[model samples]
Target: MTGSRKSADALGEAETIALRVLGFIASTEDLFDVFVNASGVSADHVPTLAEDPEFLAAVLDFLLMDDRWVIDFAKAEGIAPEVVMQARAGLPGGDLPNWT
Candidate 1:
């Protein structure tokens, strides 16, 4: 699904996606734990990292690692399932699978 030009043109879709992803993590303990563990960001510093787009992309990337999480987040957030990939691509590295 195409995102609104207004949202995309404003602060950027990455920001919206990041915030929503963070919200998703906030609502789920296990997901938050996994993000904290995998991201290696101290629990106390998560708020700071949450302000970082790269880090937010990492959050989305983490979700991208699992189809279930992607689907779940989509359903829960009421966003298009395609938003995940768009958000993933909005990150620093885009959404290409790592072969290295």
Candidate 2:
């Protein structure tokens, strides 16, 4: 397949996953809080992620690595792309990595 086609396919999958993650988040406050607190991310991040599927999935992956079920749900569903990019971009400013 062409590069653009491949990119589009990947993005479509990411969007599906991101929507699932958002649905899960709305259902589970525990998971939502876990992601927000553990990620050290703000609610403002949501709108950005909603607009960008790939970034959302990346953010969910980041949150899930903590090994908490609450976070795992987000990873399973996938998050939007921009949120992940923004959150990851901000990590270097933190005293310690979020993974820890």
> Which lDDT values do the candidates have, in the order given?
0.80, 0.55
Compared with the true structure, model 2 gives a TM-score of: 0.52
Encode model 1's per-residue lDDT on 4-100: one tens digit a residue: 7654553377778878988888788688888888988898998888787788788888888888888888999898878887777776777567675
Tens digits of per-residue lDDT, candidate 2, 14-65, equal 5655556566765676766766776676878776666664456555464445
Misplaced by over 4 Å in model 2 are 66-100
* Steric clash pairs (candidate 1): none
User: What TM-score against the true fold does each predicted structure earn?
Assistant: 0.80, 0.52
Query: How accurate locally is residue 74 in candidate 1, as Cα lDDT from 0 to 100?
Result: 91
